[model samples]
Target: MLPRLRHAAVVAALVCALCCAPAGATYSIVACDAAGDCGAAVATHNLAVGASVIYAQAKVGAVATQFETNPQYGPKGLALLARGVAPADALQRLLEEDGGFDGGDIGERQVGLVDARGRAATHTGAAAQASAWAGARSGEGFAVQGNGLASAEVLEAMAEAYRGGRGDLSERLMAALRAGQRAGGQRIGAMSAALRVATVAGGFQDIDLRVDAAADPVADLARLDDQFHAHQAMLGAERAARSGDAAAARAQRNEALRLSHQWDRIWRRAARLAMQLGEDERALEYLGVFASANPVWAREEVDDALYARLRQRPQFVRLREGLGAQEPGG
Candidate 1:
């Protein structure tokens, strides 16, 4: 668990109260991993919660806009964090631009921010406090906030879960969302959830997901998270292979293959990459798997120019002859 740390007065006040958000970001957290990953996770009773509440850049920071949300805070805050502004200072500057620091546009908005260095700041506006419950808590690397929730315990549980979490930054954020749900989420019952984590700060998000309309957004999001990791491992395998890290490529490839059997396209993609890596045998193995599960798709893949090298192989000939293939190792 990450250690608790004292925060600036901005976080001292749940410091923001911007404008009314069209849809809610009922409870959320923004954080930075010691590994230079930064992200935001949010669950709300709103469609496409991800489109509204969370923003992150790899080595920069993450921002969560809550209550009467202010959309600009995300990009603007990140820009500030990226420019070397501390989280507290960044939040203040955002507020200043939105209106005036004393109160400005701080209607019912709330915000949580964490810079790449683990510095945190969070603030909930007075307007937001009028809701059933609204507040925020911050520590060394995270901030959790909630409004119109069952109680303050929601954010507290999020903070606890984040601190106790392990593994990748995305996984930890998901754990926190689950914990918040367990503790009693939104007053109206959460209808949506989102999780985003960047492995390269401003680069493509390593894990970006949303459950806009589900009976249980948290559970749905969990399933997506698991599948996303499998895809991520597959990409990792390709990267390792391309970089000439044969051992790493093999290990990640095996993991991807193990985790991706249920995903119809993963095997074909894996096979294509394997062929490019000069692993003819491995390519044959994965293509066999894809063909067994999706014969129609396999036919297209086998004919693709990427597999031209494997065209004359006896095994390839056999596979093409029997598109109705059986599972590999059979």
Candidate 2:
């Protein structure tokens, strides 16, 4: 009877441990962009569980809390900043209030925040995984923190990468994430990643990407970032075309095409823009590229509304027919 009682007690303890433990081991960076926008990005080893780990309110601040994460801390910290609390003071309030839960084991939490003014703060709990080498670092415009990392060098590498990289806040944040991965990522690797940037307008200004699950989340995130830039270039081309700047439109479209050769949509858009500019040879070239990349467009005789001007061109017809011939039933 005594042995059975002991066994039941042990089982209950294990169940409680499993139920109460948060799922993710995470690394994150928060920053203020050159244009004074603020944002945050985080990567974690739990599928879809860390989306809320990083939070930002445009022109207010950004926050990321992890380790034995209490996601509520993210919003609460940001709200504190929104009310004019200093970054350090806001972090203190979070640490103080965090004591009301989980038997006051605030030492198990890690957090980082950057205010709209570029003030930064970070904290790492003593109770984080020993193998993780948990740590935090802060600089002029950024804060980086991590737990369940292979070494403390991971934290330093991220900070250095962000400080040294050029371009916008999103680019620097991505550099930091890649640096952490190269230095030695989380002990179990990552499954989900997210990047968000906010401007004074309170929306995604530059980037807002999420990878819910992937074998290599950081690498996949880099790919997504490239795709984002390609799309942005395409939009710039369209805007230039609408403004009647043919040279600028052509340059932007060519840049988009250079960035993402696999993106069939860019080829199609480039063809339409060329047609609008009356560059018939360039239009035919783009159409041929699009048809070669997207066989279905040719097989179904699908014509874009913008391509009406080119519908009767012998070169365009030949390109479409050539593409159709590659289909099984053609």
Candidate 3:
């Protein structure tokens, strides 16, 4: 009779623990675009969720590891995808190899993946059910996963947003995150968020942004994304100009000009593009803006070949002279 009583107590304790486990987990999406770039976005009740939950490699793949997060799955999963393993097969191997993962173990993990070719996969372990809500959804070029959410609807909202959203890979990820938040995000509310897009063309450039702690992390992340928005337009302008799509170039240039004002570094890019496009007056104006924002750039401009055409211009000569005058009592 005592043995039966002890068993009942043990079972009760297990049930209580499962229902009341820590709820500070994450919701995330991983995706790859037609350009073969990979990226991830994540938000959570915990601090700096992006620091550990997201992983990606340019033209390789992306991974979102949350719940009982095992960061190793990120790089390893990326390597598997790079080797041409399907997303589902890569996840299976990750679980098989994690047999010795002492912390949290496989059952406590939830992950999503996407390769450069748009193949996708996801997993929600049994232990993930201990959280308030946990699940994953996968589609053509993206996978969405979440845990400790207010409701299962968060996962569905993310998947729907990704499928229906427009813009680049990063924008789609952001759209999905916003949708999840509207559907009911992390059960206790989000403390942090992050977004990362791996570079295409041999990993030359990437977009990595984060909102470490905030009253409204997703909103803050969106604010931060504005900087990259301008940067993307700047790159688009350069590409369009190079390809001789003058109308496209003008529109992209206007976008970069309109949005990049708050981000001083983009002035240099605008100047470079203007110079390449033979808009010398605009180039000189942008260069002046760049120099004003970053004083050190004043001296560098005098020697840069990109500005050679303007070197002999009176305005530039005075600008160079001003640098020397500002130096000592010249």
Candidate 4:
């Protein structure tokens, strides 16, 4: 009799604990451009949910599966989309395959899908936490979803931001993420955030950044995006120089250098660009900064033909000699 009573008490305690535990929350947005460039941004109270909750494949689509989240849905969903499955049908197939937390009911899962064609679909499980006020909204070329949100307005604001924001797909998606957070975001706040954008046949992502954990993940994510853009400008400078647009190349290189003056690679590349543009003094200045930051790069000989003219300059010779003197063996 006593054993039976104790068992009942234990079960009751377990039930109470389960009921009191806080539900996890995630807010996410996915958008596609007219050129079929797809991108996704997500913020969650959980660490690195972006890695699992947001999945996107170039020329296919983006997926955000959350709320009692299942990680497998990411890759599998993209694969289905790659196979030419419609967004709705792909989501349904995921539901069919996984069934649900229970036997066959997905009453607690929240998912959003957007294909390369800009077709979108969203689902919010009926059983999502009430405090979260789970909901989703879809627009012309984007979808926003949230679980454990402060209210339905969270997703609404995200959708509105995506629709009204200016700039490219990444900018619009970031604007939506900021809007969702301002609209209350998750009741518990955010710890992790991510942004990923893929261009059609571009062979590489335009933006891929993640803030795994931070006091202000969204802000950190924005900072990362700024850095990414600065780096992209540097790449543009390189390409412009290769294409014989010296004036455009110089402007782009200067812009990147202004944004990130401390980075060794940017300085090195800028030095080379200035040399090619016949800006000997500017090239020497850039090389000085690069050598100071990266002693190893100074020790290596400049082999690029673009620097042949600058290499004959007295300042260039002195810079290399100074670097060699600073070497360990020297």
Measured by TM-score, the strongest candidate is: 2
lDDT of 3 by residue, 19-125 (tens): 65556468999998888878999998888887888998877889998887888899899999999999888988887676536456566668898898889888776
Residue 325 shift from truth in candidate 3, angstroms:
12
* TM-score computed on alpha carbons, candidate 2: 0.82
Q: What TM-score against the true fold does each predicted structure earn?
A: 0.72, 0.82, 0.72, 0.76
After superposing candidate 3 on the true structure, give the runs of residues whose Cα lies further than 4 Å from its correct spot: 1-19, 99-102, 202-204, 235-250, 267-330
lDDT of 2: 0.76
Ranking by lDDT: 3, 1, 4, 2
Give the clashing residue pairs of candidate 4, or none.
Answer: 132-148
lDDT of each: 0.80, 0.76, 0.80, 0.77
Best by lDDT: 3
Q: Model 1, 191-298: lDDT tens per residue?
A: 889999888634344778889898899988887887777787888988998898978987887777776646767787788778877889988988888888888888
Question: How many steric overlaps are in each model, in order?
Answer: 16, 0, 0, 1
Candidate 4: worst-modelled 10 consecutive residues by lDDT: 1-10
lDDT by residue (tens digit), candidate 4, 1-330: 122234433543455346642385889998787878888999999888667788777788888887777777788888998999988888777766764444323445678889888888876654543334777888777788887888889989898888889877787889999999998988888899999888776654467789999999998887777667668889999899999998889888877887674778888878877877778788889888988888887567344456667666788778767876443333
Tens-place lDDT per residue, model 2, 1-330, is 123234433543455456554433688899986576787778888876346678887778899877777787888998999999999888877876775365534556678989888898876654553334667889998899887787888889998999999876777888999999999978777889888887676433456789999999888787777677777788899999999997899889888888774678878778777878888788788777777888786445335555566667788677657765442343
